[model samples]
Target: MHPLNDIFVQSAAIFLELATSEFMRYILAAAGLHLLLSTLLKPLVRRRKIRPAWPPKGQVRREILASIRSVLVFSMLSLGAVWAVKAGWTQVYREADAHGWFYFGISVLVLIVGHDTWFYWVHRLLHDKRLYQGWHHLHHRSFNPTPFTAFAFNTGEAFLHGLFTPLLILVLPVSYLALFVFSVHMIVRNTVGHCGVELFPATRGGRPLLGWLTTVTHHDLHHASPGWNYGLYFTFWDRLMKTEHPDYLKHFSAAVRAEPMKRAKPVALSIAIAASVFCAAVLSGSGRAEATETAALETISGRWVTEGYGAVVRLQPCDKAPMELCGRLDWIWDPASGSYLGMEMLSGFRLQGAEWRDGEITIPGKNQVFRSTIKVLDHNTLKVRGCALVVCRKQTWRRLESLPHIGLR
Candidate 1:
């Protein structure tokens, strides 16, 4: 094949892979979370009998089709990314240590702020009378948005929005890990914005330092009435441009204050007890070797203190991918530290032979991942070893029954 033809072929291949991967990521993160939250809060929705109903009929199907198209557009943008990186047109660095940790940290902050600005302006442009019908109407169709609405942009809008990362890399030197983190943050915030529930605490949304941040109510209102709140990831632009809805706080308060199911607490408690009993019975009835293996598996599934005591992570079975184990950061020891709670620290682990292998462990603050292995050492201790190339480090973590309170008296 001709050289240019070869590039096209490669880009096409890249597009397909990226499209499939992005679709899975979006669906799993958005739809899975939507299902979990909707199911868990079904009783609350029922009791409150809110208007516009949870997930209007035919809305999910339309959202899915629109999202599929958007993912394709995003994949085309990814093709541009691949070509740019190959042609030496981008400043994306592979080594996290290339510019040191300080530069890496600053670059991530810059990337986020830059993207927020870009999104705000582009979003406002999409809402223009001339462009709204052609470019953004598909997304606005979801008058009562759900998490699936997060990626349900028209092809033109998706292409425009997806250009941010590719363009950012052309001008700014960012570590690959930083780019990955930014992408994850974008999806999570986007999903939460369209989740149709106000997950933020009622008080936090009213505080001076935090009140400026946008919430679900802020974005949902924009979906309900499309002339304002065009910012993404933050409220800086909306507040500065005076586009924020006046009654945002009031709507948020009412949404959060809606009555929860009276029986939810007792139902949750009963389920927890039943699960505990089932697990205990299975372990107690097994033979010696079988019981030991079961105990090890159970031991691995709980709160654990990380090696450096920097964070506490909970290891649990991934509900979407049941064959694999996942670990998420639950808390950090340093209250002043940057927020990393709820981020996945370990993922894709599967048991092979006597040990849990084929997993990747992310070292928070370091922006690095290592091929990792976990071995249950008795019932209280776990041996975790991570290797980068040939250099390897092993850490012993103790299982914690619960997180420790670290605040000052």
Candidate 2:
């Protein structure tokens, strides 16, 4: 046998011992946490309880029946686990003096993760039409779910569930403790999928810190919309195969939006202040760019500058004046590549009105294009505003007095 098979043969034994040990507490905590989230988020995360193919029942008879089916399936599964043990496999841990608690925990986690990876793919396949009418559809019979609705699948569906772990043990050497942890992880993630409503944060794209952690909301959506949301834990498989529903991201967005912005007010103020200062500087006269006929107001024309180089901006009224106006910006700077990254952004604004206006400014040199608009506050100062995205921002430029007076004729 390969090193991995040997370890799994070993893991099969350890799994039974830990299952009998304090491992139950870890399982309980994971279950409790998911339950708490589901209960709390029910009202906020719920859909309209629209039963499409199936109608609602008074009591959870269907759910109970499903749970019974699941229990039967697992009872059969124990045979596989037990068989490995009877073959003199578990004797290593039973008789061996010991490696202590740390080794034990690691093994349990592997077992659980291996189980999940297996279940995710197999459960996904069992949803096919041929398989569904026979096995998977039994669970779908109760469209509107309750906690007990979990595990309410036909016996055939249960085999698909067991297929993943057995195949997993054949590939790599996973620890027994890790398997248990993974099992607990799978159980909680599993229960939440059938959870009538989702409570945990439904991450879009994935968790920012721990990318790709699935939430109960995704599974709930699947129950609500069969033929979609096949992935049990992560949306990766669903996304890759395009089995995920159309509005999946929308659901995730709502969860992300619900997050309270603790620093929103302060952040807004800081942005506003930075904008105000930059505006004051721009309008105060800095550099001047070449003249363009697009200028809305001839009076707004002048030199806009930063702390260093100056960009000359000129506006000549064009196309019958009052209605149509065009503008242009040219950046004049000491061409030194190193100056760009130096704290004082040596490359933020080069075009005068282009920096502030909500219009397009073309950079023919680099194949880059941008838009900006400017609002003059005084002869010496003005506000320039523009954006690359939906988020708009402002920067100020001061009118430079030191430059030679090159007024429009």
- Candidate with maximal TM-score: 1
Model 2, residue 193: distance off in Å is 2.3
**Alpha-carbon RMSD, candidate 1:** 16.7
Per-residue lDDT tens digits for candidate 2, residues 174-275, read 444344446545554565555444334323332322236555556767777876877666667777778777876666555444334563344335434433
Residue 127 local lDDT, model 2: 68
Query: How do the residues 1-409 of candidate 1 rate in per-residue lDDT, one tens digit apiece?
Result: 2434434544565677678767876776676556545565455444322134666799989998999999998888888786688578999876776899999889888988888899899998998899999999999889888878989998889989999999889999988779866766677678768877665434433322257667777788899879878887788899899998887767766765532446435444543443343333323322343455455556579888877676778898765554467899887777655477788899967664467765789876676787777888867678998776655678988777533453311
Best by lDDT: 1
Per-candidate TM-score against the hidden true structure: 0.61, 0.46
State model 1's lDDT.
Answer: 0.72
Question: How many residue pairs collide in each prediction?
Answer: 0, 68
Q: Runs in model 2 with CA error above 4 Å?
A: 1-55, 88-116, 166-176, 202-211, 255-257, 263-409
Total clashing pairs in model 2: 68
